[model samples]
Target: MFAFYDLETTGTSPAFDQPLQFAAILTDNDLNEAERVDIRCRLAPHILPAPWALAVTGISPDQLVDPDLPSWFEFSHQISDLIKRWAPATWAGYNTLAFDEEFLRQSFYQNLHPNLYQTQFANNDRLDLMKVIYAVRDREPDALKWPLDDLGRESFKLDRLAPENGFANHDAHDALGDVEATIHIASVIRKHAPAVWDQCLLNRDKHEVDRLLQSGHPVCLIERFGAAQPRSYFGVFAGTNPQNNNSVAFLDLDLCDASIIDANDQDLAKAVAASPKLIRTIAINKAPNVFPVANPRSAHGSLAQLVSAHPEFHQRVGQALANRYADKEPAQHVEQLIYDRFYNAGDKRVLEDFEVADWRDRAQIVAQLDDLRLKQLGMRLIFSNAPEFAPKKYRSAASAAIRDRWLTKEPSTPWTTKAIVEKQLHEIVCGEVLNMDQICALQDFYHARISEIDI
Candidate 1:
């Protein structure tokens, strides 16, 4: 089974932005639809939608704050329940691993849901169709009609790719429309390039990916760096990151030196850190576009064998990978601290209670949480959803935070601010070609949002 899902969000920052719509379809192994859901919610009080994002998605201000829609808190519960009901399936989407997955994870986190990684746990796995498409394009170029953008470059955007490949009504930015288009493209690949599709499904499981990488065999890794064309490299399992099992190191056989395996710790670390890297890191959990190398060259096999024989070298590589982020600053915002630590069992139980409690009692349940981050987030959630239920201090503090977030002049802040939206609206009106109606809609959204800010 598979769940093809898509999210239409307010902005790109997963830590700060929120999802406005979540649309998904449960499909059989062959991409036959079984069940579907389309969920939407009113905007959170602290969120100011990006003018450009609203323009792109054709979402108006009235739609964002519709009185009839469920609150964001209720919407999160509905999404969580749907996922639980459709468990043990491969959750998939177009470019979901890079974007939608993060948003979904953050949504669960902010809502104080017990399981932040619902998609990856409980026999559930994930597949990013965009990543699979990249592999298919590299290995089976004629499998589908590849569309080119206006600049004459190969286009992989779902809107363009789906229509070019025979999907007649490709709704570009709508969440549910994109989900159906994704399933159509997946069906094409499944039919035309079954081998590629099977390999992608097999690699969706991190355990399977680990086994393959550790089998002392050469594998083909397909990756696209920036705007460059997708390319395939013969890679061998070099090591696994000591700190995170999900992150594994693979030596690019095309660029590696056999002698580097015997280098000292400092030299090997430098080699791992070098640009145009000899070692490429792969996030196994991301459904990396890795496939077995057919008719491997003798030299490639020999290099892979040498790397496998040296366990000490693997340790050093893992250490080097771990050291790469040793100097990085810790996350300051609560949103960015999602992965800092897992909740204790006590907090998890309380969170389970928090979900069922009435809005008036949720504040008391928040006090029972052991994790400070969860407590803070829980208070904010209460203030956003039902202010009268929140403690007076929390309500006052949340209001002040919203004011500073919206009215701040800081240019580098991650969240969308009123001034930033104003500037973006001006740029869109001046530079981008837009009809007068579209222009007015954007302006109306901006003015309405600004007027609501108490400051």
Candidate 2:
């Protein structure tokens, strides 16, 4: 089973923004639809929608706070129940691994569920179609209809790709419309390039990845970035480095490109950290975003070429990796546990107890937590679910910052005021940014809007 999901949110910042709508499509192994869910909730009082986001999504404050809509708590519970029912299945989406996944995790946390279980369970895994699309383009460019932006760069945005590729996307920003487009795109890939699709699906299994990494051979890696397109490279599983217990680092074959490979150990150590080459590291317990290099010839030549060409390549890479973080300060306890994937039995009970506790009891529970990581995490939960209950003395600087940001008021833009509109019109006439006829039309529209205002 594969669960394809999408979210429409108030803004881009996952830490501060909240979801307004959610859509999910459940399909069998072959991409046949089995179930679909579309949900919307009344906007929480604490959330303020961004103006640009509102323009793109076309969801007004009036619409979001409609009395007929479900409450956020009820809506989140429904989403949690649906995901739990479909557990032990692969969760696939375009650009979701980085964006939607975080939103969903935060939602679960705010709702008081074990936040990370959906994506972290042994039987569950994740696949990002955006990454898969990058891989497909590398192998077979003609397999799918690719879109290019105005600058002629390849584009992977769902809205643009949908209409170009013959998928219906009537509601471009609607959660359900995006979900349909994702499913359609997945189906097209499976039909045109079965090999790419199959391997991507196969790699979702953690055990398969473990076996491949344990082989100590070179493999193609596809990594996604939140701000840019996906990048692929040839790398080897450079077993656990000095990062953490579950840390896994990849040795980039390109790092041996004559510079560091020939340098002495001392120089190599500093060079590796400074090198622009990517040394991909991930948590071993988490689902890997990389796939096996399908065609060794086209990728980074043969594995033998990477090995024998530089005899000391392996040793040099190890030296660089070992010294990379030798003197760096460690992460905070809460962040370290998140990186280490160290949730245990006690933590589970703590989460359950924290969720159901009243504000006073919740504060008491947070105070009593012995584990520094759990205590920090518990304070965050308190701030999210019961902010009024959080003790002033225990609140961290970071927590205070988030609270300040969420409560801060934004001033209205100049374009929204009549005084600014008249000034802008004068500037436009004098500056010649627009013609006289265009300025006249704009003034006419402004007057008409003003006349229609109830005030």
Q: TM-score for every candidate vs. truth?
A: 0.97, 0.72
Per-residue lDDT tens digits for candidate 2, residues 87-148, read 86788787887798887776765454656657657467888888678777766567888888
Task: Indicate which candidate wins on lDDT.
Answer: 1
| Candidate 2 TM-score over all chains jointly | 0.72
CA shift at 450, candidate 2, in angstroms? 25
Q: Model 1 reaches what TM-score against the true structure?
A: 0.97
Candidate 1 — what's its lDDT? 0.89
Across 282-379, the per-residue lDDT of candidate 1 in tens digits comes to 99988898898878999998888998999888888988899888999998789999999988999999998998889889979999888999999999
Pairs in clash, predicted candidate 1: none
